[model samples]
Target: MSVTKTSPTTNTDASLLADHEVESTYRSVNNVQLHIVTAGDPDAPLVILLHGHPDFWYGWRDQISPLVEAGFRVVVPDQRGCNLSEAPDGVDAYRLSELSADVCELIHSEGQESAHVIGHDFGGFVAWNVALRQPSIVDRLGILNVPHPTVYRDTLKSSPQQIARSWYVWFYQVPKLPEWMLRRNGMDNMVASLEVTSNSGTFDEETIERYRAAWQHTGVHPRINWYRGFRRSGSPSRNTVTQPTLICWGTEDIALLPSMAEKSVDYCENGQLRMFPNASHWVHHEREEVTEELLRHLSQNSLS
Candidate 1:
């Protein structure tokens, strides 16, 4: 991993969302400084947006305005190792427990005892752990396009189709080569990954370039290290998610099967799954209805 410090440029055009108040700042958590960009009123109920792999806080661009307009404070962070956040070395530093702790401290640092958590892809994986390991700090949970870790582990072992789709997870486990390939061709692969997996025309050229610039930032290796740590962490315990959970999945997701979404609800004491048949892995972007549905779910389960 490159140790050089480089900050990615953000799309500062307010017209991207229109009339939204955005603040970019850093917070010290778990010995690492995390870049947090917040929208909406701080006095409103807190809603933390956790983006998936190969994405930073900007991934929540679409949802931020609607969520804020719905009378909730939206906090999006560059999740420790992505974009401007501190990227600590070593596989142990990227462990799920440590990642969850960063989030726990984030809520406390923001002057909230708990906050509503919404996550997509790998971010969904972290949200699950947060609810399980620190239920008190997560008032409600929203997951997009990623299965519960328990169900995912079992599915990976039993489902051939899922295992086939997840071939990259294994590939990412390889030392150095995956990083080299990711950075090759000026991060064309990273841009392609988003374009191919998302609905047609979901990502414009500018959007793709923004993601490429983020990957160019130093310490992106920890993004891949997340998969490595998961591979080494072995199986997760059979823990029931006690929070009111909403699992919104794109049925057309190529990486994860729809069955995993249904199975995820079984582990939650209180969970609901919303499916989007036409959408792919990037459901939040492909379907605008996602933000509205999420607002309803988040509002319904609010502890405030």
Candidate 2:
């Protein structure tokens, strides 16, 4: 549980970090070291924000300040293989079980029995698994734009529409081609993909450049390995989530269908789903109310 403070890198905005009083630190969790940025008080209720694929800790920049103002100790991590975090070799290393363990160990490292866990895209996949595999470590669950693993797996098998939209998942199974495509032209494809997938103006030039810096810094292989590892990760034995869950979805998501969001709620004992018709896959950025919803969800039965 060793934690070391680190200086801000090119991928991070020093002024924004200073404005929010965000502290960057590295913690040895599971078998790898993860770069995490935390804000707010040390003793406040812990809220862990996990970013999705092709993204790092900066994805949650919009929510951190609001959460901190709401009296939460917000910890956003560049989950393994994304930004400054350690990228372990091999596809097997990125398995869902391994990903879930990292979150659990992170909670323990923070000296908390459980924390409010929130995630988006690939991050949501990890968050769902954390609640399913280790329910005790998650006080509440917040998901954005990703379905439950079982729902997604089952849908891919049964729904033609979902299968069609998820063609990239299979393409990523290829050894090096996918990585090369993502890295070529200074990662122009990766940058374009983000813009095309989200609402207009959701990703401006400055924000896109930050993501470009992170992708160039870490390369795309380790991140693509998450998709490659998915085929090998297999499904979890238990699919139901026991914790109070809040699922926020953007109806215009290009990858995941909104119907999957409805099915995902079926797997939760106590879950609420809010759909943003105007927003795209990046609901947190496009909609201001999402932060309010998340704050309300996390404030329920506050541990403080």
Candidate 3:
């Protein structure tokens, strides 16, 4: 399908994205139409940014303009079941393999065989699995605040502390309740989850409201299905990731432990880990250091 042209900005988000030349489009990938935001020169090298749960393409507002100025065309997509993207029925539709395939087909639809892939949180899970399942199509890999599946699965089963920190995961497993609970009071619960989980004041009033609005589009069920699918699917078979990968983690994350960052690297044949002690799960927003590191990593990879 040819890319559909639309404006990426909303009244609330426009002020934040005012300076960037952002374009919104819908691309048919993996039998679903995903809302994608693109910036920079079409002829430039492609860098795909994937956002995690409870976010849409706007989640990369901080990084999008910077990456574009760095000379790479950026593609930020609202993955399956999030924001303007099509939400297919059933948990099976949201599995890791299917999620990665959506990315695979997205790149193909963009007239590129490969791209520099970066993902945060759940998007990191998709990014990791994409590189594992289709290494040839991924030129470089970057993951933030998400562990390698092998390490995370083990931690969830064996580490009581991790299980405790991830109590929401278990809570989200019950059908429909999490969705209902999060949507209450204009998504006050969802907004609070982002605010309290991050470093104090990382999410300003405008940011929180914008996120809440984004979540309202696809609603709670599709957003939570990623967890439900993951829980049902179990650990993936592929254990080793040979891609030159960069994992950036914030130490103060309330959900994922810092040790999981180190263990995530062990799964990669060529990987590096950078930790931000003062930052929370929302590292990219908490500090500019991770953005600088990401640019450096991408530049190095491009030269290699």
Candidate 4:
């Protein structure tokens, strides 16, 4: 494992977890080196934040301070194949089982038996798998703007609306074209997609630039590999979630339907769903209300 300090590039970069004191390091976990940003006391209850597609640890910037101040150690990682994290070649390397193992190993790396796990978008999918595959390592599960794996699969097959919205996933199946298109014109198309899919003012110029920097460092192929890998990963063997779960969703998500949220709860033994009518797929970016809700969920039913 290699550890080093992160040099700040902009004012926003400098302010990341500024009040709580931030530590950036690279740890070899699950056969890949992951770049992780951590804050709050090392002894506090752990809470891991997983970011989604085309996003890095910075995606959880808005909620990090709040979680830290509330007496929780927050660990946000640039999952393998994104940002400064090591990206292993091949779509199979990015499979759901492999991604889930990274999280499980990450918890052990922190010297923790279990931790509250929360994720958004693709991260949410990873979180769900982690809870399902290794329930004992997850104290609580929180998913933002993503449905259960089975729900997502069933929706994609049964609902034309979902299939239509997910046209990009099919487009990504092509070998090199999707990567070329995403990288064209200084990543203008990729930047535009973020702005268009999210609610107005969700991603400002500075934020977009921050993402652009990470995208340039990681390249587009590994990120696109997530979609490609999922296509070949096959259906999940275990769908039931025994751990306490919270699903926070933005109803206006262009890619996933709101009905999936209600359906997702069905698979959980004890699960609750909160819908943000006006928020888009980037519900975690909404910050205030979602953060409060997350804190409440994590605080309840202490597993420690």
Candidate 5:
């Protein structure tokens, strides 16, 4: 599904996770190599985290230790076109359906019939769509930011608030300029916007540099093509989520207004929302502690 989110003030190939060390491995899905990071025992209930654009598996660095310590094996993949993952040419290569299929294949590789999922930004987009496509594999869902595409489209048409907040989606629709600007300007704007969008400046000097590295990776055109593909694909097929869902939103997010956030719960059959008044688009990072609590809640709820 396509999302009308703000475009990165920049996108590049800069590393974002500096303080923590990440172990990497590969899993083949859809005839492409998927770079994934696994932490904890292979026998534990798998928790898969997905990162959005200009970010990588390291996006979950802060949550990895806590999640593993909680007795859940955590997995974070660099999706098909981002980071070390295979960057196959073509917009269709990164479609919502294809993204879901990749996760499905990854789960099967770990010898599991189903897995719990948590995604941020574009990764959340993939998570939501995957739940719809393969409810059998989605045990529970935790989403940070990244609204329902249906609500997003309706908001774009009706709510001037969401429209004003999402001016960057249109900017990204431009060809060549975004790539050139990101390479020339670096990720200062993207990082700054991320900081500004969130209540806290998690996108500090250090964090911004890391995001720049991922955005600037080779074949970034196909990576950026994710946004272009969505715009061209338009609204995707909406499927009711059979899995329980926990959605966390930051009221301070500049891209998605709180009203749109409040009104979007009907899409899930079993859904809950946790609001972070001071958080922004990257609520997961801004309120990592609180988001983890919600994850624990999801774990327990699913077990019951």
Candidate 6:
């Protein structure tokens, strides 16, 4: 990633009917029609959720039901180039700045003036920009297992171990091979990784199939484009994250450690940290109950 201090963040949530998420669609920063899975009352306070790389809104499955029950209107989008979301053909459309706009449009389209935003992994990355770019549109923020962009850059520079953990990112920088590997060995590896890496094993054959089906789409280039955008994106560095925020880290995450997570509060004017000592990268899934608690705490910060 290039080094810089600037950028911003999309939305609706559509889910499979088995769980009864409402079917909806929204346009992204790129103006592509995208589907979203949403639950809760539109009239209630809004909480829009986002998922990260190699994942979709399903990543928030455990928390969604609980959060909705807790009385927050939750919106979880597939995000640009993921699952039901639009995948613009060219890589240029997948840049971070553009990705940030997707978030903005979703909020603009929501008709609500503001929302509590939550994101995991890449979603967390986008969450930062969304909250930053449109502070008035966001009420609060919750981020799981993703450091601020700049802190992540420091990890790559200062720690060889962190670099090693991020080897997949290097592989993803390639043109087509990463997708090919994922299409083959990558899926099973991801499933296996989920079983051991998270505090609880949420991955099963059925879940993997859903993910696979999403990946089997024609516009996978945009998915790879996110990694490609990293090269063009400014070098990740720590900067002010002004949103009232909560950062959650899975302690056992092979790719990240507590030290990097600790750096988040430096930029955050108002921030809190929650760590899952036994959970890996998928901290929310590993410690579902605790994740729900933090999400509730952050989302309800402005409640009447």
Per-residue lDDT over 1-304 for candidate 5, one digit per residue giving the tens place of the 0 to 100 score: 2222234444322133332344577888878887788877789888899998667887777887777777788888988777667777777877787888899999999999998988888898888877877788988888888777677777899987778777877877788987666556555665655566666557666666656656555435666778877776534455467688888887777777777666667788888888888777777777766656655765694467
lDDT of 1 by residue, 1-304 (tens): 2344655565422233555477788899888888888888788889999988888888998898889888899888888778777788888787888788888899888899999999999999889999988888998899999999999989999999999999999999889998888878777778878977888998988878777777766545788988887776644454899989999989889899899999999999999889999899999998888888889888986544
Please estimate how well model 4 matches the true structure, expressed as its whole-model Cα lDDT. Answer: 0.87
The TM-score ranking, best first, is 2, 4, 1, 3, 5, 6
TM-score, model 2 to reference: 0.95
> Which regions of candidate 5 deviate over 4 angstroms?
1-22, 234-238, 301-303
Model 4 misplacement above 4 A: 1-17
The residue pairs in collision within model 4 are none
lDDT of each: 0.84, 0.88, 0.84, 0.87, 0.73, 0.71
Give the 10-residue window scoring lowest on summed lDDT in candidate 1. Answer: 11-20
Candidate 2: tens digits of C-alpha lDDT, residues 92-172: 988989998999999888989999999999999999999999999999999999999999999999999999999999999
- Model 4, 1-304: lDDT tens digits are 2222244354333245456488788888989998899888899999999999878899898898889888899999999888778888889988888999999999999999999999999999999999988999999999999999999999998999999999999999999999999989989988988987899999999789888877776688888989998888855568899998999999989989999999999999999999998999999887479999999999885534
Residue-level lDDT tens digits of model 6 in 106-190: 7767777788888888888888877776677778888888888878887789998888887877887887876666556636654
**Cα RMSD to the true fold for all candidates:** 2.2, 3.1, 3.4, 3.0, 5.1, 6.3
Per-residue error (Å), model 1, residue 297: 0.9
Candidate 5 displacement at residue 176 in angstroms:
1.3
TM-score of each: 0.94, 0.95, 0.93, 0.94, 0.87, 0.86
Ten residues in sequence with the least summed lDDT for candidate 4: 1-10
Candidate that scores best on TM-score? 2
| Whole-structure CA lDDT of model 2 | 0.88
* Candidate with more favorable, higher lDDT: 4 or 5: 4
